[model samples]
Target: MHRLIAALVFLFCATVRVFPHADKVEDRLVMHFATGGHPPSNGRWEDINHRHLAEVKGTPTLTNIGPAVALQFNGYTDHMLVPIKPEDLPVTAISLAAWVIVNETMADGGIISYAQDNGPQEKGFALGFDERSFTFSLATEKADDGDGKLTRIRANTPLTAGKWHYVVGTYDGETMKLFVNGREEATSKEQGGKILYPAKGRFTIGAYIDDNEFHAMDGALYEAKVYGRAMVATEIQAAARQNRALLDHESSINKELKFVVAPYLQFGTRDSMTIMCETSAEAQMLVEYAERQPLVSRTRSEEARLINTVTLSGLKPHTQYFYRVTCTDKNGNVARSDILTLQTAPGPETPWAFGIIGDTQRNPEVTKRATDGIFALRPNMTIHCGDVVDDGFAKHQWVSDLFAPSATLFSHVPLFPVIGNHEKNAHWYYDYFHLPKPEYYYTFTYGNAQFFMIDSNKDLSPGSEQYRWLEAELRKSKATWKFTCHHHPCFSSDENDYGDRWKGKAPEGFRSGDENAQRLVELYEKYRVDVAFAGHIHSYERAWPILQMQVNQKNGVRYIVSGGGGGGLEQAAPQRAWFTVHVQRGHHYCYAAVHDRTIQFKAYDLEGRLFDTFELTKGR
Candidate 1:
């Protein structure tokens, strides 16, 4: 009897070990494709689990990466397939993860999918690309009253093409989640119950199962993995961190020429300013400055870094200084920037002249001409109302279209720029320009005028941070004149006011029929703002002192749209708005001369023609 009990106990222990609880099971499949062994022409990809090997279709090449290998897909007809039985796929919980490097933008493509076909009844899951966003979907038989439906979650921010990114999709029975770069981007509820998978369906990588759909990936893929159970947030984050290390390793392989971007100015003030520049290699920076043409004072930064910035203080207000920057790269290459001049802000009660320009995208030559015209006016400083480049992400645009064309003007005069939609709130804009605190929206005092630069791309309704800050700044301001600059005119008469191609639908933050616009107008009236300047219509428009959308020249505010700074021109509406006093279609800019309580304004076209002129007088 004792021997029989021992035998039964041993058998029970063996059964428990073989059939653990479903939640306790840690079943996973990892595929490091083409990393070590090359697949045959039949396209069989071996998996680490040894249970299923993928079948390759079309033509895919194996590229050597050090001692390992990586698979390349032509994005058209190439794909890797793995036949999976219904029982092999996870039903209650699952996770799919991959590291991908997209070659270019595609209309539509699948990265990984288990669906049988593109039909509505196809039962499985798919992680794919739709336009610029990454999408994840799950098909279930019970989703839509037994008719079979798909539950999809998309990443909040679009993924940039031609870059390496880590993506993961998981379903924890009750919730569906999508993560990008270790951060949870999107989530969906009501995804409980088991997932549906067709009995004969095959798991596909880099292409959909439907041959006629042409939804194939065009990129390089590495380190693909799948798990039967949904991975917790910490596990997914750890996978992303590991992928980042691999990306860093790949980036460190190439050593190219340095000095991609030239030296530029930032944080200009009455007595201090900063000079910033970028280099491809580590470098030391030196700057020489003096009041005269031949610089005498020298400042040097000993620390070596790719991005270099140095501040110069103890400067005299209302004085002009000449400076030059020199950098010594790690490889002993020395480069010197052009000698430039900087003019400090004038003291209180001093007369000052400043220029305004806007919408200079896609017209570098025209922008150069306008800057020359503004320089001819000899303004002490400049205010740009936004849209500085056609594409803020394109480095060449900033160099050829903006910096190179306006180098002389930028070096001599401090520029206060408003955030434009075209800039896309890119980090490069923030890195290049140094504005007041909370740079997107801030106020600065120059002479007897207080200039406020705001980000019209953001929410500015009553309780918004920007709106509250603006009200406080206006209430506390003691300057004799107040001026605000931003993209999107507060009172435009151009076709842009009618929306894109006259759809009659305005942009969210734009001035026409927008809550932000109405709130801003009320603030302007209450504060007795001297003038508000804006761009984005690609034309010139000036409104009479307007209050509550009507002419109130006594104490109301003037709204001007001077978007004609080199962008393609747009015509004013056939029937102008009631407040529109003058409007013109041309590439132009505005020049303002402020003296105590009076401001003389002039608008000029590219040909140096003075199209509009006005004067503002406050406090008698």
Candidate 2:
């Protein structure tokens, strides 16, 4: 009888050990810009095919010159602007992509402008770049009302050097988005007002109406594509990650980057399976690199060593799992690899919680300290509201400011990051994280809430397709709570930012600059959104339930600015009619708890002492 019991126990242990095989998720798509690409049939603006100086005609050829004619640039370096007639093409969603090697950096960096004209100066929209960093921006105005304003959504990354890099700008009336390579790095919005033009003239590129002489492009331009519809995030990433197909298993033997998926994997189990690793290099040399790792679980095979890869499965859906990479080449050699982590989707059945962090660009040490604090609190997941690394486009700074300091915690946490104005490389943010949407704006769910992670640093207007999508999402959500997080603060107390203040100084719905700010605030109020958070100002603040200045606690949504994840120090605003509570200035990390009845928030300094706290009740 005792022997029989032991056998049964062993069988039970083996059953529990069975692992699940992983189903592969399709890779995100990235659209590449070769030269002379064709626009959608609706494209009518300055077609790259009909250049005034030289015809760049072609039918979306991979190269610049072709027979079908793909895109057209104004080439009006001498002050001549390209004009587009509405009859030529009417578009609700548009994205512009190109590969450029700048001839020289601008002395002060002025506008390298792209404008939609309604006859010379009647009214229209304009996008430009700052003189200092080749950062992109947007400016719009109504020629008749003069009520339009400029919304500058600066790219977080830099446009420097003579290297080839992909750049894309997308405008869906409601949201302006910018992508580098294939990753979204910035987003912004214009309120309800139009940067309306008289529509009498043509669209222009490179030179503005204000220029004295028509200046032609000084740099090489390649692969410019304009799409009439908003490009899906997944489609964009897949294109970006596409590489020349290497020789298959049946082909050559000289390849070095080939990776093999392991066998005996269960669909949803924690069993770590071994992957047989071998290279063209001698087995002994490969073994030398393997034995150095401590976490690598391996065994000797006939041709190579079988090392286990950490399998993150059977987790509480939508949670961050911390892990490390370990491997063995041959000869019983082992080495410890870098620690890494991933966030699992919420179990197909329920919702979860996550935190937000942003702009740790100024003071990395403080950011590091805050990161430790956030990890200690243990959120199901986290979000960096852009600018986690200053000079984000710069490779070295990204390592020091973001990766190095945050690695310890990041390895254990799953972070869903949004594009900030600081990331510039087409692949700057992509090479770092495994995001659900390779592009900048994405949507995810947790518990009773649906979160909209958007880009507020580029030009997305309200009437655009992005806005239409947002409306559809809000309408479809059955979740009890709705939250949105982005970088720039819509209404903040940064006294230096005159744009945030509205006291008769500016009309309520008037050109307060970036009407999207005003429009978003209005939408949140209308939809009964529970909370909205933002970070650009580098301080911690909370607004009272307010709509058009009248305290509508019952219906008003709450707005919080918690950008103080250790960037440049900033002061907060004092008590105001619209402010329920606030922490104008502090060096702290934000904490949140999603519970049955309400969503609670608190701010903590590096020492773990609570500096600010508030409770937001939830319900119909």
**TM-score of predicted model 2?**
0.47
How far is 360's C-alpha from truth in model 1 (Å)? Answer: 1.1
lDDT of 2 at 355: 58
List model 1 lDDT by residue over 185-281, tens digit each.
Answer: 8898856688887556657887756534556786656546677777778977876664454444342112232455566666567787777766767
RMSD value for candidate 1: 24.9
Best by TM-score: 1
The sequence of per-residue lDDT tens digits that candidate 2 reaches over residues 359-402 is 78757688889888888887766777777677766766665677
Give TM per candidate. Answer: 0.56, 0.47
Clashes of each: 1, 100
Candidate 2 — what's its lDDT? 0.49
Q: Per-residue error at 101 for model 1, in Å?
A: 48
Q: Per the 3 Å backbone cut-off, how many clashing residue pairs does candidate 1 have?
A: 1
TM accuracy, model 1 = 0.56
Q: Model 1, stretches more than 4 Å misplaced?
A: 1-262, 305-307, 499-515
